[model samples]
Target chain A: DVKVTQSSRYLVKRTGEKVFLECVQDMDHENMFWYRQDPGLGLRLIYFSYDVKMKEKGDIPEGYSVSREKKERFSLILESASTNQTSMYLCASSLSYGNTIYFGEGSWLTVV
Target chain B: AQSVTQLDSHVSVSEGTPVLLRCNYSSSYSPSLFWYVQHPNKGLQLLLKYTSAATLVKGINGFEAEFKKSETSFHLTKPSAHMSDAAEYFCVVSTTGGGNKLTFGTGTQLKVEL
Candidate 1:
């Protein structure tokens, strides 16, 4: 079975603090994504990387950035966390277009 | 561009009763549709997907969905409701032009009672 591991299952940070959420996929998938999920908004993509060192902004990318220094690892960065940024962050990966995207267990981040 | 709509925000069913979740979609090109289930505090699980192969697609946990091009709908269904089936279900759509990016519906919360 494919495993998408998220480094943190829960985190609490003060406003203005820098936050990092890490994800690693064991399947060697080429496409990796970061999505923010909220109560009524479902899942909105924040950023995605199709290759190492390459990144693309998604629908909701204003408060987030991403890094893919290695093929299996994709990281989401919050330069300065805010109360509005408190939500569940999900990491997903897929082989390519038209393939099933597998998701991680998700990291719940709370900004106070 | 592609988009998805889940008609009902919530659906309730008694155990052993049938389950149905309605979904509609619009796209500029032929689309790939998927149904995903998210259990409480858990990750999203792919229940099924439609990729133009067959109109009817069967998935894990006795769940299935049918693709109707004429109606532009992909509705999920099951023969009987199980207490364990209670969760939030999302309808997602993607197109060739859209690459791997997907548009998701707001989601429908399923509630199963005795």
Candidate 2:
């Protein structure tokens, strides 16, 4: 079974704080992604990396960045957190471009 | 440009009743469609996928979907609804040449009644 593990299941941060959300996939998938899920808006892509050190901005990449340092690990960064950035962050990885993907349990971040 | 649309934001059904969640899509090329379910406070789970192989796709939890290229739709259905079926469902599309990118629908909240 493929497993995507998120480092933090819940987090609370004050406005203007830098937040980091880490994700590790045991499957060693090549493609990784960061998505922010909000009510009514659904899951919007934030960024995706096809390989280590390579990233592409997705539909909703503003105020967010991502890093893929290893084959099995991807990280999402919130440079400066704000109340609007409070939402559930999901990390996903796929075997290849457009192939079936797996999602982490999700990191719920709350900005005060 | 490719996009996915989930027709209803919310659908209510009773247990043992039929379930239908409609989704429509527009893509520049032959698309890969998927239906994902998310329980409250949980991550998204892939319910089923249409990869152009079969028009009718059966998925986990006794759910299924049918792809209609003519209408550009991939609608999810279940013969019976269970209380456990209550969740937020999303429709996603991956265009042939769109790389690994997936366009997601706004989402539909399925409420199963007793």
Candidate 3:
């Protein structure tokens, strides 16, 4: 079974704080993604990386950045957290550009 | 750009009854479709996928979906509904462009009544 793990399951941060959410996939998938889920909006993609050091913006990438320094690790960075940024963050990885995706349990971030 | 529309924002059904969730999509290419379920406070789980191989696709939890090109719809159905089946179901579509990026619907919340 493929397992994707996020560093934090629950986090709380204050406004204007820099927040980092880390994800690691055991399957060594080549494609990784970051998405923030909100009520009524569903899951909106934030950023995705097809390979190490390569990143692409998703539909809702504003105020968010991502890093893929290694194959197994992907990081989502919040430049400066805001109250509106509070939401459930999900990380997913796929073996290829278009394939079955395995998702991490998700990190719930709260910005105060 | 490709997009998906889940016709219902919420569907309520009794246990042991059939479950139906409607989804429609528009894509420039043949397109791949998927149904994902998310329990409260849990991650999304892929219930099934349609890769153009067959029009009728069977998925986990006794659920299935049919792809109708004429209607441009992929609706998810199940023979029986259980209490555990209550969750948010999302209809996803993948187009050929943009490196197979996926587009998700607004999502339908399924409520199973006793």
Candidate 4:
């Protein structure tokens, strides 16, 4: 079965600290995405990578950056983590630009 | 721009009863609609999608949704509710053309009682 694995299931970081969330997909999909899920807000896209070294900003891309140095891995970086950024982060990948997407288990981050 | 709205914030039902989760969307053109289920502390799973091919779409776990153009709604329904069916449901919409970025609704929490 296709699988997407996240580096961390739960994380806690101090305010103003830089944080990194990693995701790896086994499907070798061309499109990967990062979204933050919050209570009542549903899921909001943060950043997405179409290919290695290619990235696009989603609706909620702010104070965040992404890296896609390899085909299987995508990383989301928070330049300075804040309390407001605490939420569940999800990673998804699709075989093509527009197709069925698979999601990872998600990483829950708490910034104090 | 495209957007989705889940009319109900919460729905309570007894086991073996029917379930209905309301959703409405707005888009300049035709849109690709989807329903997702998120169990507690788990990732969101795709329940079903409507790509304008068919008005009625069936998803996993015996859940189905009908897309109505005149009403601009894609409401999820199930004939019978199970104890395990309690979870959060989200209505999402993506533009047909342009990019495939999805816009999600706030989501509705379903509670199943005995």
Candidate 5:
């Protein structure tokens, strides 16, 4: 089975602290995505990478940035974590356009 | 552009009764629709998908959804509700020619009463 592994399951950080969430997929898919899920707001895309060195901004890319140094790994970086950034973050990967996508278990982060 | 809307915030049904979860979507062109289920603290799983082939799509765990173009809806249903079926279901929309960006709805929480 294809697997998408998230590095952190839970994390607590102080306000203004830099945070990083890492994801790795074994399927070798070209598309990788980062989304933050919140109550009533649902899952909002933060960023996505379509190639090894390419990245694109999604609808809710306000304070988030992404790095796709390699094809199998994608990382989400929060320059300065804030209280409002506390939410469940999800990582996903897909083969191509409109194909079935797979997700990681998700990382819950809390900024105080 | 494409977007999705899950009609209910929550739905409750008896264990042996039928289950229904409503969804609606809009797009500039023909869109690929999907239903995903997320259990507590787990990753989202694909329940079913509609890629313009069949109007009715069947998924795992006895879940099925029908695509109605006239109503612009893809509603999920199950013949019998099981306690393990309790989870949050999301309606999603994507396009074949539009870079495959996924747009998800707020989700509907299904509660099974035994």
Candidate 6:
């Protein structure tokens, strides 16, 4: 079975604090993605990386950035967390385009 | 460009009753469709996918969805609702040109009653 592991299940951070949400996939997937999920609005992609050191902005990339220094690991960085940024962050990876994208358990971040 | 729309925000069904969750999509290129289920406080799980192979696609946990090109719809259904079936369902769409990017619907919350 493929497993996508998220480092943090939950976290509380003060406004203006930097936040890091880490994800690691056991499967050697070439594509990794970070998405923000909220009520009413569905999962909006924040960023995605098809290769190490290469990233692309998604529909809702504002207020967020991502790092993929290694192939199996991807990290979402919040430069300055804010109250509006409080939401569930999900990490996903796929073998390639048009394939099943497996997802992590998700990290719930609360900004106060 | 591709987009998905889930028709119902919420659907209530009693155990042993039929279940239906409607979805419609539009894509500039040939599209691939998927239905994902998210349980409470859990990650999204792929229930089924339609990649132009077959019109009727069967998925895990007795769930299935049919693809109708004439209607541009992919509706998920099950013969009987189970208590464990209560979850949020999302309809997603992607195209060959999208390059691994998926467009998601707002989602439908399914409530199963006794």
lDDT of each: 0.95, 0.92, 0.93, 0.92, 0.94, 0.95
lDDT of 5 by residue, B1-114 (tens): 788888899999999899999999998889899999999999899999999898999999999999999999999999999999999999999986556689999999999998
- What TM-score, over all chains together, does every model reach? 0.99, 0.98, 0.98, 0.96, 0.98, 0.99
* Candidate achieving the largest DockQ: 5
- Which lDDT value does model 2 have at B45? 94
Q: What is the Cα root-mean-square deviation between model 6 and the actual structure?
A: 0.7
| lDDT per residue (tens digit) for residues A1-112 in model 3 | 9999998999999999999999999997999999889989988999999999999899999899999999999999999999999999999998884578888989999999
DockQ of each: 0.83, 0.72, 0.70, 0.65, 0.84, 0.82
lDDT by residue (tens digit), candidate 1, A10-93: 999999999999999999999999999999889999999999999999999998889999999999999999999999999999
Q: Quote the positional error of residue B20 for candidate 3 in Å.
A: 0.5
How large is the interface RMSD of each prediction? 0.7, 1.2, 1.2, 1.6, 0.9, 0.7
lDDT of 5 by residue, A30-86 (tens): 999999999898899999988998998998898888899999999999999999999
Provide the global lDDT of candidate 1 against the true structure.
0.95
lDDT by residue (B85-112, candidate 2, tens digit) is: 9999999999757767998999999999
Deviating ranges (above 4 Å) for candidate 5? none
- Candidates sorted by DockQ, best first: 5, 1, 6, 2, 3, 4
Worst 10 residues of 3 chain B by lDDT: B94-103
Q: What lDDT does candidate 5 reach at residue A91?
A: 99
lDDT tens per residue, model 4, B1-114? 888999999999999999999999999978888898999999888999988788999999999999999999999999999999999999988785537677889999999999
Docking class of 3: medium
**lDDT string, candidate 1, B1-114, tens digits:** 888999999999999999999999999998999999999889999999999999999999999999999999999999999999999999999898886688899999999999
Instruction: Give the range of the ten consecutive residues with the poorest summed lDDT in model 3 chain A.
Output: A94-103
Candidate 1 chain B worst ten-residue window by lDDT? B94-103
- Candidate 6 segments exceeding 4 Å error: none
Candidate 3, residues B5-113, lDDT tens digits: the string is: 9999999999999999999999988898999999988899999999889899999999999999999999999999999999999999987785657888999999999
lDDT of 6: 0.95
TM-score of 3: 0.98
TM-score, model 6, chain B versus true chain B: 0.98
